[model samples]
Target: MSAAWVLGKRALREGRRTPDALLPTLFIPLFFLVVNVGQAAKIFPAASTEFLHGQGYGAFQLPSSLLLAASFGTAALFLVEEIEGGYFDKLRASPVPRSAIVLGRLIAELVKAVAITTVLVLLGLAFGISIASGPVGFVLLVALTALWAVVFVGFMQIIALKTRSAAATNSAGLVFFPLLFLTPNFVPRDLLTRPMEIAATLNPVTYVMEALRSLILEDLEWGTIAPGFAVVLALGAVMLALNVRVIQRYD
Candidate 1:
């Protein structure tokens, strides 16, 4: 078998065997979706503001939950599993191209992201959350989610390759929240605190949130979506380079 196939199968098997690995990807987003959407109206009185650039709280916060499921949650689990299983070491020693190992993990992360998004989309539909930009915008939303999964997972893999400890992986996962919360996630960008405004200005997650907001809220603004997608690709490349170096240095 090809090395990519071997590594891919390994990832698939590990994912299936550990319910914990996949369960959070399914439930955490759903839980947050329900809780946040329920409270957004009550909490963010300005959600009704047309100047905010999003429809309402539910649609506004949906991308954050989706991105969390795609990156922070599932990426942590995958890293922890690889560390616990000593699969990273095994892959390092194998004759397979290093890219195969990385690609396999990226593929696995994408699958997990898709599953999470699919479930959330169904829930959103049930709650009457339709795409504002028509069918193309809806497709872009899914594409962006998957793309973000690839880039974010690559970034996490770089951390995982260096740390090689579940505890450290967990710590690294927590690092995402500051970036996530500092953005215009629940509240609109116009209502952000000064510190939050600065943080959101620097955060790549903000770009993604903005892009998703544009699509789902029927606000077809390429100015918002393009930068987010571009940054995702740019960051992915840097992370992939770091991952390659870490793997090469693996003892």
Candidate 2:
């Protein structure tokens, strides 16, 4: 645990030193949020959009942006750099537990997620969006979003460990784009066409978006929010296991 903590701190420090790498993670999401809201706000004004539950279209779209922000993690890229620099080999030869190496990067991702979620939420509020679940829900929203980020970074780390290539790890991040778009980003799942609705239903990212939308557009509805947490936990478990296995077998 201590080793994981130390490594997590080191990762955080490294992130601090490379703000340029961090900007795109925040910027792209913000750009999507602004563009989506601008394009659709008129069509789905809060005054008439039942799905929005009296909130602006920005509220409905905020979760998509949050999820996008969480998906743009740099941990795997950093891992590739460590591998190429031989630092990863040094850690492997040391007394650090293999799991610590993975958890350390995830811990840093969780921290970054919290910061990114907070910034985006604040910006959402600035755009006249409000959280119906209030402050407690706000906290839960950030926690869940950050957990999803960690889960994604775990998958990316698996790629990093297996290929040990910066290019492959970066390319792997693009896979999340289709996952994001396949969800009901611009409309309610019920409102989507039959085929797209089924597609969105199968997409796990849909649950995360609905869960976050519930927090922003409605009161504390655990029935709606629990599934998002469940998905995150399940994905985190699988990703972490795979990451550790890859590291254990890494040459």
Candidate 3:
């Protein structure tokens, strides 16, 4: 655990020094939030949109933006850098446990997620959005978002470890775009076409988005919220296990 902590701190320090690496992670999402709200705010005004629960379209769309922000993690890219520079090999040969290597990166991702989620939430508030579940929901929202980020970064790390190529690792992140759009980003799931609805239902990301949307547009709906956390936990377990196994077997 101590070794993991040290490596996590190191990752945080490196991230701090390379703020440029985070610009896209932050900007693209914020841009999407602004653009989506601008384009759809009138069509789905808070006064009329049944699904929005009296909140503007921004509130409904905020979760999608939050998920998008979490998806743009750079941990795997950094891991690729380390691999290329030979530092990762040194760590593998050292006394540090393989699990710590993976945990350390995830720890850094949790911190990053918290900061990004806070910023997006504040921005959402400024745009006339509020958490219907209030302070408690706010806490859960941050926790869930951070957990998703850690899980996502873990998956990205798997790509980094398996491919050992920065370009492939970075490019693979684009696959999330389809996952993002397949969800009910602009409206409720029932409103989607039959085919689209089925696809959204199958996409685990949909549950996470709805869980976040529930927090913003309605009060604590445990039924809605539970599924999001469940998906994150299940996905996190798989991603973490795969990450550790990949690192352990890496030549």
Residues 1-251 of candidate 2 have per-residue lDDT tens digits of 99999999999999999999998889999999889989989999788878889988888989999999999869899999999999998889999898899889999999999998999999888878898999999999999999999989998999899888999999999999999888998998988999999999999989998999999999999998999999999999999899888888887
List the candidate 2 regions with Cα displacement exceeding 4 Å. none
- Which tens-of-lDDT digit does each residue in 191-225 have in candidate 1? 78888888888888888888987888765789988
TM-score of each: 0.88, 0.98, 0.98
Cα error, residue 24 of model 2, in Å, equals 1.2
- For all candidates in order, the CA lDDT equals 0.74, 0.92, 0.91
Ten contiguous residues with the weakest lDDT in model 1: 45-54
Tens digit per residue, CA lDDT, model 3, 109-165: 999889989988987888778999999999999889999999889999999999999
Error at 18, model 3, angstroms = 0.8
Clashes of each: 0, 0, 0
lDDT of 2 at 128: 85
